[model samples]
Target: MAEQSLVFSFFLIFTGAAILATLALYTRQPLLVAYIVLGALLGPYGLSLVTDTALLADISHIGIIFLLFLLGLDMQPSHLLHMLKKATLVAIASSLIFMATGYGASLLFGFSQIEALIIGAALMFSSTIIGIKLLPTTVLHHRHTGELVVGLLLLQDVIAILVLLLLYSGNNEEQSGALAFLKTLAALPLMTAGAFLFVRYVLLRLLQSFDRFHEYIFLLALGWCLGMAELAQAIGLSAEMGAFVAGVTLATSPISQYIATSLKPLRDFFLILFFFSIGASFNLALVDAILVPSLVMTALVLALKPVVFRFLLIRISESKKLAWEIGFRLGQISEFSLLIAYLATSAALIGQEASHVIQATTILTFLFSSYLVIFNFPSPIAISDRLRKD
Candidate 1:
């Protein structure tokens, strides 16, 4: 906690993360898992090398805001409409299914109603970051498997945003549920129209005028993300949702890819810190209390989530194999799940033990998912061989 130790901790943690991430890449695993392991080793549970995790958590949270900004820059409304129905249906169905299963399992494990609900919602999201990163750029992503993954995860992101909104609204004592829900609902249209107008008139025009100025574009992108976040808070909506909406609004811009590419390094840096902070802040004492629930949740995610996703994709006109592949690739839990769980715990919407459960489940699913997706890439070929014999 001292000034010198604080400086030393930051350096050591990030350095360790960087080295482990490199090794992860060499071994064909996602860097996220590496980051989590680094956090576990350096965090309270392990070496206790870092003491000011709270400060790091706050700093890393800005990465979330920035990430949403870049995501918004690419998510133009017209683009969303192209696959709106499919995205909406898949996201809704899968999220509901996961929530119900997750909630039931949590209660069976002895969690309170509120904790169960919070953890259930947290379990509803799949890791877009890890999913996309693990996906093969040439075959799986461009083919049916990739599209299904994108559509399903896109839907989950929207639902996650909405869940965060509801949680934020439900926190206050005086606000009636109906009124709060109404307020949240009303803000959506206004937010959309405002963002649309901004993009159509302001952002696009600015890009045209300053296409060469990457620096200015970057600043504009950052402002757009945080600005929308602040605006959402002012209007009784969740800032996180606002940031995601902002990303979706910019989805169709020709400059979207450039913005994403340019900002990716920055995103990675923050995410490293963000995930590390997640591990460091974890309370080891609660691990014993939630171990069974965590394992149950992890099993559900690892075994059932992909099956649900695969079924949904098949129902929506995708090939069985591609759908199955997509499902397996995304079967793991996500970083967003951890963030929501943490927020719920911090806000007392969920219990501390529940937060630990989410953390453990997330890490478990992450490890297993990476292995299943990355190492099992050759399995699809084996499936084809079996079909040939049949």
Candidate 2:
């Protein structure tokens, strides 16, 4: 009876996911949103269809691993380096600016100082996954707005990775703070240099030899990603960072696209599980305590994130219209923000309320982003005109 119950729960959650996914497709909404909604409906907070939340949480880690791996496959070390120079500067400036703004807002809204700080920092990250997905599949990705958005998103992802590493490694111990910070700072350079060297000298040669064997190439890529991810974790770097670097290492290869496509199904599968776990494991008590604050946070993200993007792009010589359009395209909280919230919770650096706050904000923002992007093209000047009025 016990085993049957567990099996039944798994089937229920998976079935809900599948059914909601189809609904999402039909409605032109993001599948991510559907998964969250489904999870919430089936989780203990609702229908109580998914009783083994811990089991789902454990399996969800695989999604994170594969998510990072796919991200790695898409990044080219050389291109990433070039993109990083601009991305780093922009990411730092934008993150600091927004963190201050968000923190101030949180304080104004009566949150505790520590909670405010966590909220601000988590809000700094933009979602690479959501942003990229919202982009049209046409040739526009090569355009100015697409390119700028892509670069900025990449920059935020790198920053998010570093933040996760330090926060988690610190173990919430005041004594470990300095060491963890220093270690994280050191790991970035080492990882970058190491990935470049490995890809240029080792991977390039290996890839050349096995280019003809597609299956071998795919398996090799997979092995390299997972192997590096474990090594990175052992060395105190993030598996997410390691996987991203792995992808960047292969970005210059002719087979990069093939690898990305090959890994897509895996990435999608795991990522959906990740999002579902997020919904399933939601802390229900937060609904009453954080609801108002989460709404405020969501509005800030939706309204201000794009404004910052527009200002930066315009400063960099992009046309105002292009900048506004791109900014509107990014007007949402990212998955990384939720990930950071989770890390902070794990480190005891922040409360579960903070995690719930971020999760809700991200879910709300994703819903808004799906609508904005899907409608933007049909009403091209709609967003830009509104910006003008404001």
Candidate 3:
């Protein structure tokens, strides 16, 4: 019966998603928003067709790992390093300004100091999925704007991982925060060394030997990605970071493009589940209580992020048009914000109200940002004929 229910739930989700996605395309709406709405309608808080969101969420997280892995595969090591170096100062400066904005706004809304701090931290990152999803692959993939956006997002991902580590450490009475920090610091070099050694000595040789077998190559790529992810988790680092490293190590391989192309549909499948899980997990009943503060914070994030990013990018010698485009492309709070809120609430570091506030704000930004990008820029689902690009 339990197995039957899980299968039934997936059937409903995919069926509903297809209908909604088609309607979204006809109506010139974002398909991501349609998936979220479908989840909200069918999930626990609504009609209750699917009640085990936690299980779905766990499965959906693999989507993020795959997303990061693909991102790494696309970037050559030298190009990635150059972009990171150029964007580091801009990323840091923009993050500090956004954090201060969030902190001040939360305090003004009567949140506790710790709650404000957590909220502020959550505001520091922009949505990687939305930013990359909306970008036209042909124009942005190798363009200057793409490089800057990717660089900043990568730095933010590192900061988010460290923040998560701190939250985890805080939950354990026996663990010293400094020790956790040092462990994470140490894990970077260790993971890099391990990835390179394995790729050079084992993975590349296997791929070379089995180059004729497409199916075998695909299995090997999945194995390599998941293996690194598990290894990273075994250490103090994040699985996403590890998956990225796995991809990076294989970036120079002749078969990297084949792997990337073959795995895209698989990646998209998991990502749909991920976006649905986001909507399914939220409880609308709690939103009313945090509505006022949440709206204020959301508005501030939507407005200030672009301005801050543009200013910083311009100051760092980026072109005005490029700066503005990158800024607007990143003008939304990240999915990591939702994760931070969940972790803080679970750890008893913040109240349910605060968590709800963060969730609501993140969703609001996701909705608006997607529309903004779709209407104004070149996207896969752009409303305008001229702006639509593959």
Candidate 4:
């Protein structure tokens, strides 16, 4: 089949999304879920209508970068630092528990040790896309909740960076590999400091001077966000992480709210594509082969993550209700999990079987965990009108 043009793909996706999203709302299901199902239906795996998976994936990622940038606009660096400090123990403890659960589940299905290792690593982190996208930011209760969720996710992103570094470094010479990875890791702090300086000495002044030029401010914000994202990638960190940093740098600026509000619509557009790309990229053919094992690991993660998080959080003196809410919000596997599967498979570290299992399980958990949060919590995409805060 010929690959669809970008314009045509957009048309198909939005048109299909509209129909499915209406059905989703009528049935009181999350709109994000509809986006996923539409991807599966029209994606190469389902109908082969949209065959340029790589392009779609790349374009869709801007959505995540924008999401993080917008999220940062609402936060203060001090609050983020404090929350990260307070939540460190919970993040570490919860990751270990979730890792063990995934390892055990993978081993139960007779996957090799390496396969289990990758799966376990993938399972430890929760979906930042879902965790933040669904979270409502305007409300008081949710604002507090957002701080905790963002903190834990940031910590988890650090761990994920380490894991990706390990995955890319390969296993030829353990000691040298570790040293080389550590060397690259040193760039993160330096880059962050540089970002602060750039934001303070350059970007803020531009924003202040151009505040009256709404169009210029919007373009400048986009340029700053994407420029930082690319720089972060060059420095061996994730683009989304860089986008978050860019947002946080401007968090103190007076125009942050305006920037955040303006970028939201564009963010939502890309996000729809992001979720659609996810379902499209999934191979339906492999689902049956990996289904049983994927289901096992999926159940373990979905069941244990929330409970373990809640337990650890309560032990750290977090209120019971809020802790439980955080737990469920973070109950799914992450997009990093999908990235790991792809990188691991490419590196020949894990076989197709294991990769499929990780991909399948991650998507499943995305589905389940999204439903769990939307139904029970206040989110921008909540099914209940009262719970919807956007």
Cα error, residue 150 of model 4, in Å, equals: 0.2
**Residues 229-291, candidate 4, lDDT per residue (tens digit)?**
999888778898899999998999999999999999999899999999989998899877898
- In candidate 3, what are the lDDT values of residues 1-390, reduced to their tens digit? 989998998998899999999999898899999989988999999899999999888888898888888877877888888999998998888888888988999899889999999999999999988888787656654366776788899899888988888888787755577788888888888898889998999999999999999999999999999999999988888788888899889999989989999988988888888888888988989877999998898889878888888888888898787787888899999989999999999899999988988998888899998988888777878999998886
* Tens digits of lDDT, candidate 1, 122-179: 8888887667656543343344444456566666765776676666656666466557
In order of TM-score, best first, we have 3, 4, 2, 1
In candidate 2, clashing pairs total: 4
Better candidate by TM-score, 1 or 3: 3
Residue 165 CA error for candidate 4 (Å)? 0.6
Whole-model lDDT for model 1 versus the true structure? 0.75
* True lDDT of residue 51, candidate 1: 71
What is the C-alpha RMSD, rounded to one decimal, of candidate 2? 4.8
Q: Write down the lDDT of every candidate, Cα atoms only.
A: 0.75, 0.72, 0.88, 0.89
* Model 3 stretches with alpha carbons more than 4 Å out: 140-142
State the lDDT at 318 in candidate 4.
86
Each prediction's total of clashing residue pairs, residues at least 3 apart in sequence or on different chains, is 13, 4, 0, 0
